[model samples]
Target: MDLLSLDFLILAGVMLAAGAATGVLAGVFGVGGGALMVPVLFEVFGLLGVADQVRMQLAVGTSLAIIIPTSVRSYLGHRARGAVDMTLLRNWAVPIVLGVVLGAGIARFAPPSVFMGVFVFVAGVNAIKLISGTRRWDIASDLPGGLLLRAYGGVIGLLSSLIGIGGGQVANIIMTLHGRAIHQAVATSAGIGVLISIPGTFGYILAGLGQPGLPVDALGYVSLMGVMLFVPTTVLTANLGVRLAHALSRRSLEMAFGVFLAIVSVRFLYAMFAG
Candidate 1:
């Protein structure tokens, strides 16, 4: 395909527009926006004729790369509001990174169905909780510390890496269920995105290194083209999401996110059973 052809230009425009939406989602939801980006990137890669074997990995890896900057931008925005829990982040850092490494290694051989399963299970459960107005049901009076907390971090990182996310959905639900305020949960989730995406990106890169059927200019599974098209727009629009997040009531935000998770869950469920 001609790099400057009309068809390619149209897809490029689509990517830019998607990036803008992604940035807003990242900021508002304290996510890395991979839940949105993975499916979009999958379609784009398919249209671009990436091989079936490698296209999913490419999408996953590229989404992680894109999240690095978007997560940072979103994290900074949330941190400025004095809502972030630095202590939790500090505790989770090593475990999360280690889990990311393990997950990325698994990604090298896992099928798309594996990822979809993880997404459907987690997102579906969270969707039900948030949409049913049970988001505040306390699993504990407060978050656990020591080994248990680190285990949660590891799980979050592992799942996020597998599914190309920034770990927000898992972290947010965990925090909220432990009696943390929704605002603090969301803010802390943004920081988790930062921790997940950086090592996750490198892990995917290393995992896909020397793999076959990769697209041109792909750094391992990470698509440079997708990253290039996505980063600028996502970075520009992140602040808009942050502002919107702070303006909404906690209940409103929870409901919105719940709806979003519901949609994501249904989409993947269909893909899993019907596809």
Candidate 2:
């Protein structure tokens, strides 16, 4: 695809709009915008005639790059309200980063079909959990500590990196189930995005370094154009999402997020089967 072409400019505009929406969702749901951005990026890259072999990798990597800034915006917004759990964020950082490195390595070698399948499955399960409004289940009194905490962080980081997310969904689930307030969980999840995206971004870059069929202005599999066009809008809208999150009731937020996840899941499933 011609980076200078009219079509590319139009697509870049679309990406900007998507990034704004993603930022709001990231702040509101603590999803880090990856769940929303990855699929859209994949489609955009496909439209640009990116090779199938590297297209999903590019999408995932670029989505992570965008998250680097968006998540920071979200964290700041949530922190200002005193909703963030700094202790949890501090404890989870190391393991999550390690997991991101592992996940990025796997993503580099795995086929697009495998990644798509994993995304569809995880998103579907999370959507069902959100829709059901089941908060009674509790296996622990609080967030795990010591080795268990590290393991949990590792799993969240691994799955999040593989799917190009900020690890918010899984982190929220863990925190909520362990008796954390919904607001705190959502706030802390933004920090988790920082932990995951930093390592995941570089990992993808190293993994895809010297690879063929990448789009123009790419750093490894990450698209510079996508990052440039997306980050600003995300930064602008993330605070709005934080405001909305504070305003809404927990049940309302859960239901809305559930619907969003369902839509994402359905889209992935359709792509998987129809493509």
Candidate 3:
């Protein structure tokens, strides 16, 4: 395809717009923007003539690659406001990395449906709880001790890696359900994104190595071109999201996050059952 073609320009514009939205979502919801980027990349990759066999993997890998910078920027913004939980991040770090490694291994062999199933189940449950706006949804007054919390972190990392997320959605849901404030949960989630995205990106590159059907400009499953198109806009807009998140009321933030999760769940559900 010609670089100056109308189709190329349209796709470029779409990527920039998606990057902007992704940055906002990362800030407001404390996610790595994968929930939005994965779907967008899938469609964009398809339109660009990527084979069906590798399209989903390419989307996921590219999303993770893009999340690295965006998550870092968002995390720093949250940290500046003193919203981040350093102790929690430290405690969860090892288990999360281990989980990401396991998930990356699984990705090398798993089918696309496996990821869709995980995404739907996780996002759907959290969406229902937060959207209902009931105190009864609170599972405990505080997070579980030691091994249990570590296990949760592992699971969060595993799922996030498979689905190409920042692990924020999983962390935020757990934190909020255990009585943590929405702002704190959101801030902490940004840190989780940082942990997940770095290893996740490399894992994907390793996973996709030597795989057939990968497109041009791909290093394994990651599309370097896609990363180039997304990074600048995503990084520039992430701080804006942080400011908006801090400005919102606790209840308002929860509602917003819940709605975002609901949309993610629905999108995957449709793909699994209808597409």
- TM-score, every prediction: 0.95, 0.91, 0.96
Candidate 1 runs further than 4 Å off: 1-4, 135-137
What lDDT score is found at residue 155 in candidate 3? Answer: 91
Q: Pick the candidate with the highest lDDT.
A: 3
Task: For candidate 2, give the lDDT.
Answer: 0.85
lDDT of 1 by residue, 78-167 (tens): 998888999999999999999899989898677768877877876777777777877355699899989999999999998889889999
| Collision count of model 2 | 0
Query: What is the number of backbone collisions in each predicted candidate, taken in the order shown?
Result: 0, 0, 0
**Model 2 over residues 144-203: C-alpha lDDT tens digits?**
679998898998998889888998877876776677777888899998998988889998
Which lDDT value does model 2 have at 179? 78
lDDT of 3 at 205: 97
lDDT of 1: 0.89
Please report, in order, the local distance difference test score of every candidate based on alpha carbons: 0.89, 0.85, 0.90
Query: Can you rank all candidates by TM-score, best first?
Result: 3, 1, 2
Query: What lDDT does candidate 1 reach at residue 267?
Result: 72
